[model samples]
Target: MESFNAGDVAEKIMAAIQKEYKELKTLNVMVLGKTGVGKSTLINNMFSEKLADTGIGKPVTDKIRKIEKPDFPLAIYDTPGLELGGQNVVNALLADVTEEIKKGISSGDIGKMIHCIWYCISTPSHRFEQTEVDFLKAFLNQTSLINVPVIVVLTQSYSKADARSLTAEIEKENLPIVKVVPVLAEDYEIDEEYVAKAFGLDTLSEIINNVIPEAVKKTFIAVQCANLEIKKRRAQAIVATAAITAAATGAIPIPFSDAALLVPEQITMIGSITAVFGIRLEKGTIYAILSATIGTAGTTILGRTVVSNLLKLIPVAGSVAGGIISGATAAALTAALGEAYITILARVVKGEMNVKDISTAKGKKEIARIFKDLLKIKRDNNGTAIESEIETSADNTNSFEIND
Candidate 1:
């Protein structure tokens, strides 16, 4: 933990408590924009699952998507597409937000918290339709969901220049701009740095440091501490298993001929399967598809050899000898490997490691202290930002009504 500057037990407690209080409650982040602006795709990517459908066609996310994250639960309401005609479109969009907000109220704690809103738009064209502009104006003017941060995610950005120009233009809209996160989904520029920036680290950190009630924070920290203890216990189990095997083998010397041959193949197969646990392909396919298959294969064979020799104490070669060697080795190693893999996979799936979870008690406290200092960075040239800007003019025309 120190190598990564993550602190000890105290730090984990501090960070965990802060994060829990600030983020534990259910949050609804509405993805609002014109039809076909990639809102569903954004949520799908955020969740790392096909929770919502996405394509070039017209908006398919007519309903809302409720997703649960590690820290909090949320419902991402994808509003209906606005009509090409003016007032009718405004009414429809307004109605949708209002209904969702009410629904949130009905849902109790999760419903009441609309922590953030993201308005997605496509880039380069930088054109706004009447429907789009009207919707933005109506949303700003009519909604009571104030103070909630609004981010403009520009989808489909190609060049750096596009991002730069768009960021500047968007700031001029008089909206309470939080950030402009750029996405080049087609180009694979989707990184945690940008998304975290969009989510307002300063605010989030503040919540970690100060906003959450102290009692709640303590409970959350306790849960994380419990989980960490479980990991430590599993590791101890593995060590004990290995030590017992070694002691048994030292008492007797059995021929390694049959055991040696079978052990490597078994280890190799297990290692290969474990290595490709999340992959979509079959077990055989992983071996054939991955270039590192040979390395994985070798690791398995070596691992088994080490275990077999260490298990030699039983008298005379028999099925029991093989069973003890195989069972103990596989059980110990498999449990260790499975736990480790799940921890890594969870982070990969969630888009970032829990820095707060991994932080030292002191460092986490410092991070909590500096929560207010964290800032969201904006990218200039995304598609979502362009649509937001284009819609600004119409919003301006109805300024008195929307901004009121």
Candidate 2:
């Protein structure tokens, strides 16, 4: 049988990942509030990108501005802060926003349309004026007709009591909003002695996640930085899919020379997992990490030698037996690689490890140690001594290879 070409498998996996990444539609959010309500700060803190810095608000109309980063997957529509005194000014602003929404809907792409609206109110203001209330009610009524979810954000909240009071007052009016969320967005300095700590970011992120459509949830998860659990869950799903792919590839019963085919799947799995952590690594970096942890060249030789020896011991020349051994080995190895990378990334995300250290000799040694331990455990649990022995041989060799 022809040896599996690991390079071709790796290319296919990378191409799939890139295609999926590109296909995810951008998440467009409409942020409505008067100026200085922390809209820019909230967006910058909640997402991986510092959108506020790059977000140059282009006027969609006289009052509505669209803030977009070039080639980014998230866009924000910022409306002028409602002025209390002029009824005509408020009406024109509202009309302009409505017209923009209509245009998005007419485009026939829900992804191009505003996914949700965040109506922000500053908590320090203590209470909403009647005009603010009236404007919000009118805006909500207009948006509701098109099924866009509007969430009320109480920004710059200092205390729980203030947040509760504001929420109660809004609820008393019973405006048509998806929910009322109190968020601090960022830490604030009250004086030389006191500071208002940030809070409610996670709750606000969860509400947004729940309100957005399932089709765009992955995009949201990729961009949002407030919720780590959501990222972890998504990463786990990617790892599971990779494990399945590795198992399928192994079922071909190719010879030891072809064992390299499994490397690409594991590498792709690592790349996907890294993305969930919001880290962008170069292709060279990814391959280097894999080589340091898994002994790229040694793993194939070891896996093949071990599997071939096991078949000899069984006195079985059948391909089914060979397929079973290879499939189990691939699944076990891929799972181990994925789980190890996940653990390392979780630590990096949690500030337990320095991301720069990943390229260091000491860091690579630690990763190799964790990967070997996990691989051994997986093989032991699955009753695959041959697989475990292969991992042991790879570990002993400690030979890193860069395939051309």
Candidate 3:
């Protein structure tokens, strides 16, 4: 018997399981934290709903309550906030979500996986108790929930710069920092940019209006648009060349700094190239290779171009010879690739042939025929060779041949 590695076999098993259970869609999230830290507030902000009670002075939530929404259905189980020296909050949360899943299996509403774990913490600086630290310690030890994506919602705080330091400390200690959000429930004029960033949305307004009423939603959306637009426009002005080079190369060392500054300019240059040649390549697909090559060559070429040009102006080599072109060609290539990428993207957005032909009748029939043909793949009489041997014995030689 042949042996297979656990990982390879497990991957095949998982693929089979996924195909078998494809109907399961909604992602259930379990929110756990100390009371009064704003788990309810976070959910309300997420769904644009006032369903979860806010301004609760104390830990009013006692049981695991489910918070559901329209566009995104969240079986948000809000467990009782962790106490200073009482029952462990992590245990309570895990138990609750596990029970919910069990009940769901019977009730036919079980979600496939736990999508998010929003661990609401007010501010680690203010509440760095031994209990919290121990809880965190145990939290990381539990590998059972490793598959679930967790985000530490640092609520009731301000300034991303400050958040960065806090996040760095946690990361240094090896804590999973999916996202850090500083939210103020009282101001309720929530910064949608942070929300959009945390949730991976193109625009913040898309999420805001759905939560607030028509009149208030309109006002909030307008203000958010203005604020975000101003930030975007200002970003569009300065081109951080070194940062762009780093981004292109994939040696992005900065943590808190934005990748946007570097990416867009490179993207624009690549887009230009794509447009000219009518050929497209994803910046992401070729970013590292191009960035590495272009950064080195471009740097050299640019240096020589300056030297050559300067030498030409001099009486000795005036117009006879010029400095080596450090960046001209590499820069041009980057620009061309960027342009081509953009043109391709635009065509993609306009609905070109971007979809896989898996649903076509001919394709389906071909797949079915292939599967039917697989039945022909049989072991030889010796059974030593695993080959596509469609046998046609004398008794049943009606007319059968192997089809490719």
Candidate with top TM-score is: 2
With a 3 Å backbone cut-off (N, CA, C), the pairs that clash in candidate 2 are 4-258, 34-81
lDDT of 3 by residue, 14-88 (tens): 343233223224545567777777667665654423436532222313456665544322346666545545656
Q: Model 2, poorest ten-residue lDDT window?
A: 310-319
Candidate 1 backbone clash number? 19
TM-scores of the models, in the given order? 0.40, 0.80, 0.36
Off by more than 4 A, model 3: 1-24, 53-62, 69-72, 87-112, 124-127, 143-146, 159-162, 176-404
Residue-level error in angstroms, candidate 3, position 278: 36
lDDT of predicted model 3: 0.38
Model 3: lDDT of residue 213: 30
Per-residue CA lDDT of model 2 for 2-63, tens digit only, reads 54433444454456456556766889999888888888888898888888768778887777
lDDT of 2 at 382: 25
Per residue, candidate 1 scores C-alpha lDDT tens digits across 1-404 of: 11111122223323333443444343355677656766665666453234455322233235344444443333455654534456765665567666665554566554355555666766664654445555665575544354445666776555456656776666556655556666654433347554312322222223322322333332222222112322233333433343344333332222332332223332332332222222122333223211111112212322333334322211121133533433333332322222333333234334444433323343223222221111011111110111121111212222110000
Error of model 3, residue 186, in angstroms: 6.5
Q: What local distance difference test score does each model get?
A: 0.38, 0.70, 0.38
lDDT of 2: 0.70
